[model samples]
Target: MDLDMAQVRAFVHAAQEMHFGRAAGDLGVTQQALSKRIGRLESLLGTKLFERLGHGVGLTEEGRRFLESARRALAASDDAVATIAGKDRPLRVDVWGHLYAPTRTLLQVAGRADELRLELGHGRDLPGAMTALLRGDIDVALGRIHPPLSPGLAHRLVRLEPVDAVLSTDHPLASEPTLRPEQLRDSVLWAPGALERLDFLRRFADRFGVRERSGSVNLGLAHFLTEVAVDPRRFSLVPADMPLPDIPGLRSVPLVDPTPLYAWSLLWRTGSTHPGLSTLAAACAGEAGRSRWLEYDPTRDWLPDLPTDRAEAHSG
Candidate 1:
C-alpha cells in the first residue's frame, strides 16, 4: 500500500495531542479532513489506530506501537527536507507566571543539553503562553498547566516544588519557623493576579479558609513580595527554593502539615518539529528524577486537582 505522509503526520500529532481537533489545527487542516486521513490510513493498514474519547481522543494499542514507527518515518523525512532546504534555526522557548524565577528551572534544562541554541522569551501567564504556543511564537514553554488549556497544546509535567509563605517578619506568624495552612486562614491571601485568573491560588485560599483576599499588580516578584512584607496581615506564597531579594523585614516560612506545591510543565504545540523539543523533555525528565522534581505525597502535600489526574483518567 502507498502510505500518505499526510495521514502518517496526522496520526502522530493526534496521538501526541490526544485530540483530533488539535492535531488538525497543527496540520492546518480541517478536523474532518484529519479524521478522513487517519481513517484511510487505518483502512489501508486493516487496523484501528485510535479510540474516541468523550473529551478528546486516545491511541489504541496498535496506535501506540504505530506511533514509534510513524515518528521515525517523519524524522527521516524531516531530516531530508531540512538537509535540502538548509533552514536550521534556534529553538525558541518561554516561561510564564511571575512568582517563581523561571531561570532557575531553565538553567537546569540548559545544563543537561549537550549542545544547545535557544531563543528565550517570557509570557504573562498560562493563557498568554498558550497563545504564543498556538501562534508558533515559541517551540516550548515552561509553567503551570492547569486547564482549561487550548486543545492545540500538549504538555508534560516536569516540576512540583513545595511552596512557602512570604510575609513581614513582624507578622505574628513569622515568629514560628514553620506554619500550617490553618494558621493563615485569618490572614489575607495576597496574589499577583485577579483570584479568578489565578485558579491554583484561589483554590488554595478557599480550601484553607483564607477569607480575605488581596491582589497586587505584578510589578515583578520583588515588588509584590515587598508589598507582602509591608502588610503584616497579607501573605503570598512562592516556590520554596526561589530566592527572594533581601527586602528588609521580609521573611519566608515553610508550611507544614500539608504543604502546597507549585506545578510546572513543559508545553508545546502538538505537532512541533523543533529539534530541541525532545532534548528539553529528556533534560526535564532527567532532572526531575535526579532532583525529585515531580515527587508528591498526598498525605503530606496539598495540590489542586491538576491536568495529570485528567491525563491518567484518559489513559484508563
Candidate 2:
C-alpha cells in the first residue's frame, strides 16, 4: 500500500512533538487538519499510533515500534528524491553564536560559500540548534560542542581561537595588556544568552567568583558592542579572532592568566546522508587545515589553578 507523504510528515511531526497543537503549528496546519491527517494515517496502518494522555499525547506500543520503521522509510524516500532531483535544492544550515563572520569567511575561502542556505538560529547557543538537527529541522549546525555529546550526533572540529575579554574603553581594565581571570572578581561579565549554560563557564564562575550577566536572546555583535559601550561595568568574552564592530568605545583584550580557547565545530546527525552536508564538512575541514591560527593543542594546560573553596567563598 502506498502511503501519503503529507500524512507521514504529519505523523512524524506529531510523534516528535508529542503535542498536537505544537506539531500542527510546526507543520503550519490547523489542529483540526492535523488530527484528520493523523486519523487517516492510523486508519491506513490499522493501528492506534498515539493515545491521548490528559493534556498531552504519547505513542502507543505499536507506534513505538513503528517509529523506527517510519523514520527509515522517510529517510529512504528523501534520499531517493534527492538522487533523482540531480541537485540538492537548499541545504538548511543553523549557525550558533557570533561566529557567523568567521564561518562565512571560511566557507567563502573554501569555495563552498554557495552551499549555505543559512537559517541562523540561537546565536552562541548550541542546545537549541542541536535539538533542531535531531528533529530534522536543519541539515547542519555550526557551534561549540560541550563534552558528552549525544550519541546520535556527529561533529567535526572546524576551528579553535583564543578567547578575549571585551571591555568598554572607559573601564579601568580596558588598557591592561591582558587581564587575568582573578582580576575579574566582583566584576559583572556579560555573557551571550546561552553561554552560562556551558559547564566550563559554570565551574569557572564558581571558581573565580565572577558574576555573569547574559543579554537578550540571539544578541548580535553590533548590539553587544552597544551594550558594552553604554555600561562601563559590563564586559564580555568572545573569540579573539571574531570580527568586532568598529564601535569606538569597545575594545577586546586578551585573557592571559588562564587562556581560554573557543572551539567551533560542524555538527550533523550521525547517519545523515545529505550530499550537501558531506561537501560542507569537507570544505570546513579544508579551511581549518589551511588556517594557521585555528589549530588547538589539546595537551596544553590552559586554565589557571583554582583557589581554595574558602578563598572563593570569601571572594565577592
Candidate 3:
C-alpha cells in the first residue's frame, strides 16, 4: 500500500514528543487533526503504534522498531525533493553582524547568484545564528565563533580578521596608530549583549581591565554611533573588515598588543549532502586559498581554553 508522507511525519513527531498536543503544535496542526492522522497511520500499518496514557503517549514495541525506518524514509524523501528542486528553493544563509558584503561577494563569485535562491539572515549574533543552523532553520551561517566548536556541526575558517577598537574621534586613544588593550582601562567599552556573551570577549575584557557596557539587541547602528559620539569614554570592538557606519564622530583604530582576531567560519550540518551546500563550501575553500585577507589553516584551534570562572561568566 502507498503510505502518505504527511501521515508518517505526524507519526514521527507524535512519537518524538509523546504528547499529541505538543506534536500537533509543532506540526502546525490541530490536536484533533493530528489524532486522525495518527489513527490513519496506525490503520495503514494494521497495528497500534502508541499507547494512549492518562497524561501523555508512549510508543508500542512496533512503534519503537518502526521509528528508525520512518526517520530514514523521511530523510530519503527530503533528499529526493532537495535533489529535484534544490535549485528552485532558497538556500537560507545566516550572516552574523556586518560580514554580509564579503559573504555576498563570495556567493556571487561562486556563480551561485543565479543558480540558488539566497535567503540571508542578518543581525543575528553568533550564538543565535548557530542555534538557527542547528535547528535547520537555515542552511548555512557565516560568523565569528570562539570554538570548542559545537559537536554535530561542520565549519570552515573563512578568515581571521583583526578586531578593531571603534571610538569617538575625540577619544585620547583615537589618534594612536594602534591600541594596546591596557590603554583602554579607563574607557567603558560598549558591545551588543550578544557579542559580550562570547568567551573571547569575556577574556579580553578581563585581561584589559576595561569596563564593558552592553547595549540591548534592538540598538541600531545609528544609535550605537550616537552613543559613542556623545561619550568619548565609551568604545567598542568590531571586525577590522567591517565597514563602519559613516557616523561623523566615530573612528576605527586597529588593536595591537596581543592583537585579538575575530575568526569567521562557514558552518552547516556536519553530514549534509546537499549539492548546494557542497558548492558553497568549495567556493569558500577556493576563495580562502586565493584571498590575502583569509587565513586558511583548519588545523589551528583558535578558541583558548577558558578558566572555570570565565567560562561561567560568558555562559550567559
Using TM-score as the measure, the top candidate is: 2
**What does candidate 2's lDDT look like per residue over 74-93, in tens digits?**
65666566667835466678
Q: How well is each residue in 1-316 modelled by candidate 3, as lDDT tens digits?
A: 8879888888888887799999899889999999999899999999999999999999999999888677657655665776777745767887875522446445544563345456777745667776565444677888656655544567766655557788998998888988877799888867655554655566667767876546545366667667777778888776676666779888888877556655566777655556667667666656555554454232331234322222112110
> Which wins on lDDT, candidate 1 or candidate 2?
1
Supply candidate 3's per-residue lDDT for 227. Answer: 78
Candidate lDDT scores, in order, read 0.82, 0.68, 0.68
Best by lDDT: 1
lDDT of 1: 0.82
Clash pairs, model 2 backbone? 97-123, 97-124
Which 10 residues in a row give candidate 3 its minimum summed lDDT? 307-316
Candidate 1 per-residue lDDT over residues 243-266, each given as its tens digit:
889899899999989989887888
Pairs of colliding residues, candidate 3: none
Candidate 1 lDDT at 315 equals 14
TM-scores vs. true structure, each candidate = 0.71, 0.76, 0.69
Show how many residue pairs clash in every candidate, following the order shown. 0, 2, 0
Winner on TM-score between 1 and 2 is: 2
| Ranked candidates (TM-score, high to low) | 2, 1, 3
